[model samples]
Target: MIRRFRLAAVLIATTAVALPGCDRPPEEDTAARPPAPTQNADQPLELTTDSGAPLESRRGEWRDALRALLAAPDADTLATADRRWRDLYDAFNRHYLSLAAQACAGDRQAPLQRLDAWPLYPAYVDALPAWPDSGIVNDPALELSAASLRRQQGATADGEVALGFQPIRLLIAGAKGAPRQAKDLRAEGDEPAAALRERRRTYLKLAADQLQADLNALDRDDGLSLTSLRCALETLDDRLAALQTHRQATAPEEGLYIPSVSVEILEETQPKAALTQLSADANRDARAALESGYPGFQTALDQAVEEDSWAPLGEWLHAHGD
Candidate 1:
């Protein structure tokens, strides 16, 4: 099952570790989770490991590392934001896609197994303008998942829920809603639901711990390749484009995932303002690198212009290359 708490912690894992009476073995012990990728003194930090479970299994590990970098007291990443860009891209991609895949797995109800009585979900439903009839709401397997949002507890008219990453994302992002029920972790049945839920929490914490340790061991390599820098520039351009498109097309009250996901949900922060600010920050960070040397700069500039990417940036960089 996959569960996220206020967007800060999302845990998705399978099984309880050995119970004297249970057939299922204990959850995989993470004590030996892979060590951090070895340092490449030539670059900031290794973005990924050569060997691991697919991106799905290693995301939390990466997020922890990335989060630590962001929190580092040394502000040196400012000079080499390309590395941060690289890390953010991998972390964002892995996080967005993997959570959906892992949580929606196995009966599609797996993610919701533990949310049976969580409090915030009901409030989340009552407030929706109108449920999206995206077919996801009607899945039989999600009956229990939707029941958690039953507004009136037993009301048949409660809002329907689709298989969504947004609600969970909102949860993780420190949105207003939070789990209210007492979580039980005792190993109950041979295949106890309780055990898996507990294991998810344990697993998530371990993954976070692992990531932090990796971050502490990593160092910034100022000599990233030209190609890597160009890639980072393009990534920021892509994100800005997509986000602008979404913001323009989405309605204000729709809870549509970003910017306007509601100040109510955000509590203290403004994601809308922050998105624009981040794009600007990333652009500034990449500017020096993007404009670094001459002929290579022209080639990178040409690619940006040819692709019709954030044209203003391309034109500006092309006009000012050293």
Candidate 2:
């Protein structure tokens, strides 16, 4: 019953207030039907605010804020800004729905707690190979509180054992099949299904060996709990196993053809050159705003504010010092 898109918006409560017919009291409002469709149902739904303001319709004036942040002069500042913007966008785009799920499941401080718990998750997501599209399989933030609780309870060994299996989840999610219908594509070249089966086996074996090695070394020294690292590694192996089983069972006679998932990965990974510019601009604007009320930097600052550019600024200051 939780609304995915509605909960995902930044400052959703403000927009919620602006929504027409939202004032009917919680009981009645919860029963109210959604607003009438402005566009054809055949097309992707055009996102809008509660007041019927268009969101995904046109790029809007807010995009310029992103542009300004990316246009900043300092390379370091820009890099910092880029990371910040990237994290903000990633969090907003990737986990919004997932977060809603958690909140609905009854974690009140779910979002903030996540931010505190797994600081490395966003970076991990950015670095992950984008096969089958981008997403965190089990967002570290979601597990942060529970994981921390285990640590606090002195379940370090047990926790590591569980953590070792986490990567398998990613492997499964990244599989070419699943909710996505990539397996429907036909494999090309003269290689028969038998050959592909062998190849798949080889790939799975190699992946498993690497994963085992990874798991065995969990928590040797990396300050990371042996449990957490192993969870990720084991998860990867289990997913590989599942993928192999699925492929062997359902693989086409022509072999399992996924129209080059690497391309999708690469596309997802394309870096934003504008981030550096945006970051520098944001800082320059923020400083200028402080000195003279932000006329010079207002546009850029607004972008930073809109897209949550403060992340990169903080990172930049941390790396650069003072």
Candidate 3:
């Protein structure tokens, strides 16, 4: 089970393998052991139990896994943390769907709780910046989720208004990270509250631990989180070139990287790929941000480009920041 108060693991995953582009110490060259399988860009990248496992930063498997995911797209390789997360959700969906059928027994909305209506909703919400509280914990399935988080953290009834990482991650990993499906709350009528509450605790221990472990990888030194910056950079490039047409996305940690990178990156974070989505002022700001932030990374990216492989980006991140 996840112990919420547990100290985060500080070490990166260890490995005996070595990658070609990166130049680091013997102990630091923790590449994926057998090399990741190729992934197909056009396919919906299927995830199995092996692809969604949790990780410790010290062991650094998460880093290895991340490199694998980014490096190969027609290959079926997965990082430890990614695999663990997907597996957890695959299991949760089965359990959650079953609970929903029971909760709704007859109606599709037997049990629902609107957390935003609670008097202490504001304070309850401020506590979880990671989750975008929908303000409503609909159906017995979500009600149980909120209750579990509250009990684990020893929070008040008002706190039971929101779901935590365990639930949130399930949503992110599924449906391409789209908004939660519209649940039927108008059909609310009857449900077994006691049984549902009990059921919520069944996977609480496992789910909590998994969520915490992944959280550690992401919060401490996650390659997935860092990779977002790379993706965002590509988006920034497209947006700047067209000025009148491209869309712009803020790099991961755009604000944090302001002093280290460029302020224009955040100057225009809105996506404006087409003319319909364009804004003259915003585009100008985005262009400026590209100029500002591009300098710091370009020197490194240029170095990598001349080498003809993207591998140097990882080495640069190692020397600079995530």
Candidate 4:
């Protein structure tokens, strides 16, 4: 049976504002962002399981899956590879990525973590209902290069995403409600359409390559300690609390990508099983770290674990009947 951590009583709160020209909005205030977590630099940790398989191993697996997907010869092959890549991506996000982010907080690698999890808007990468001619796919003025893509990674207003996984998803899966076929991406028998098709394929490869590079950077280090774990939990708690606040003020479609991704990860598993497993893993690691010498982390860890800081997210998902 799937289990959940008991929902926390006090949720993290944040203010949300609507962005012009888009239905969804991004978080506005950064003043309440948590302070950089403290880590014991002298004692570097190697996060792994009993079998000694490092957390970054999953990143390598994901990179392999991505390469397979890009090299797919036909629609059928692409579809199969796509599903496999997505499953690995979801698993990595739910388990390893966040932990790595916490472990590397305030380190030089912190920027890489943010780039990997950057907010993505579907419209920025491909066409959407509101903006049919939107995204880099349709815009001929924008060059299809890594440098060009990097420059377009952020949003000028709210609810707009120019880069990241969502863009990659849009490029691979086609536009929302309108999936692309192998023929659609093939450059043949046309002027504008042919050029567009070629551009589409180019964008997909570049994005995937960029994503793999970031993942490789992150995989280089797997050192985490009790302090890092505590930081991870607190960050999660803050995110859940912010999600709770945002849910009250807007519709599900209008919420932030972080919450949406969090819900999607939970949904990928059986109801609450993913979160239950996540908490279990955190607690297990926390115990191991505590035994090694971090004494003061117990109070915070107990509060975070006991409250099941992610309960509010589950509640929000259920409320929307998602």
Candidate 5:
């Protein structure tokens, strides 16, 4: 069963907040500044799986592809990375994430899962018409520091996320509604402009590093329980229901990752064929874990999939019992 759910659509709550000033201009001795980290284009990216074979996790594949894209950023690589992200997002939402949530529910050592699925706000990562120079790219305070990047996540009153896939998206895609050129990223103009360009490049590198770090954190068995997988599912269901109501009342802001929202609506309005596949996949994985002598695997999964406010899971089970 191949369950391909679309990536979750993010809801952006807007607010009127004062923008900060750009980072102070670089010092006169620009040569003293540390060079941005560089990756060797010739080196192959290393990806390891639990079985020590080809990588099977979509998340791992996306991470590697993203690394490659960051190493030699170009239009083609950016497109490839975006495709990989979509694949990862779909697989995670439909199957792997559920499994992780269930595991976390039953075990104390389970990896921590993101509750909101790290939704991206384009305005938080890049400049939008209403808030030009509003994102991490233009903010000198966030430039070139992993700590700063991590600290800024969910630190705003308006729920603007400072880290994650969206910042990387803007890094590769340029500003919100503009074509990115090679020259735009290069430091080729006069002193002030060139310094800004250099800062942008440095920020891009830092953003990619921070992204990779976040992904790595998800793989750690750090005694972090993300509560029951059912909680996450129920939360998502509520969000989807609210989204539908919001759309009916008033149109959502345009250009806010509309494709992802559209995909969610399509899944909701369509048949439950995908849900069957998802159930089968979940069952198979649970059995496999049990066969490998993992205690309580089946029990945990059974509890996780129990009927709740998650409409799709409930409807599917009502139509077809486990």
Candidate 6:
């Protein structure tokens, strides 16, 4: 029973392995071995007891199993060592959902404790790598991989956090590189058609990561602390503004001009594409608000250009004046 319970505990900890796009190293990979099959063939994804008992057979058996294993003295210290980690994992999901609520255009504010609690969140999130026996029945990684596979009907989900921006990337790259024929522009510049789409995809992914960092900081709720949120908004505004300006500058030269397309792309692309629906909405709103701030920023930038008052803007951007 102790050995079996230990197995069960391993299974529970393995659930975190299900997070998509997070590839564990070979030695640390969860699912390093075959997992024991659960009782129900129809519900392969269902949690199971260490003894291969179906977790759903009893009232809240899954949680009960977790509680019991956590309380056990002799079960295995390895299980106990991850106690706080698991608790924090559960907390992160809840908090992540809650923070999603705060994502809106103008007044995004997650509760203060959530933000304050964020720095501690990564330790718990990152610790999933350390859990033992990932390929076991209790392995979360196997379930996640299975789930992701199931989700796309055997197609791998790229862990995309926003609309695939390969199109935009391709378009931009073609424009940046030596001028191509109109036919080539449409053919090769189209994200889906471009051979270099992967590179653009990479850039979009990096941008998404940057946006996520901003979201994480905003959600880091140290008592509804607006400092980071404000900074995030400001950063987003600057990026959007720069993007807008770049689009403006390049539009005439590209011969493929569409301000609306640029606007749409800027509006739709965001950091939290793979999160829960609520969190995604929150992020959308936050992004919108950030975008809304752009008008003022654009005006400021425009005035700087119009008056040739580069000194103030330059000084503001640089720590020192020439």
Give the winner by lDDT: 4
Cα lDDT of model 1 overall?
A: 0.29
CA RMSD per model (angstroms): 18.3, 23.6, 22.3, 10.8, 16.3, 25.2
lDDT of 6 by residue, 1-322 (tens): 1110122343223322111111221223333322222322122111111212221232133234334432442334324323322332333333332333233212442222212110011111111122322111122332223233223221221111112121222222222333222232222455434633233233323332332343455343333212223333233333333344444433322222223333343334321211122124334443333224322323433444555443323223222211
Residue pairs clashing, model 4: 12-241, 121-161
lDDT, candidate 4, at 299: 45
- Writing each residue's lDDT as its tens digit, candidate 3 over 1-322 gives 2212111122112111111111112234334211212322112111111112222332254335434433442224422434544443333222221222222222212121110011122212211233333222322333334355445331433222233332332222211222212121112234643443233233333334444443332222121111222233332232233222211211211110001011222222222111111123433433233324333444545555566443444344334322
TM-score of 2: 0.19
TM-score of each: 0.29, 0.19, 0.20, 0.64, 0.54, 0.21
Instruction: Supply every candidate's count of residue pairs whose N, Cα or C atoms clash at under 3 angstroms.
Output: 12, 26, 28, 2, 0, 24
1 or 6: which has the higher lDDT?
A: 1
- Per-model C-alpha lDDT, please? 0.29, 0.25, 0.28, 0.48, 0.43, 0.28
Best by TM-score: 4
lDDT-best of 2 and 4: 4
lDDT tens digits, residue span 237-310, model 2: 22222233332222111122122222222123211222232234333432332223212233433454566433
What candidate 6 gets wrong by more than 4 Å, as runs, is 1-224, 249-260, 265-322
Worst 10 residues of 6 by lDDT: 118-127
- RMSD in angstroms, candidate 4? 10.8
Give me the runs in candidate 1 sitting further than 4 Å from their true place: 1-193, 196-200, 206-219, 247-311, 314-322
What C-alpha lDDT, on a 0 to 100 scale, does residue 306 get in candidate 5?
Answer: 65
- Candidate 2 residue runs with Cα over 4 Å from true position: 1-191, 222-314, 317-319
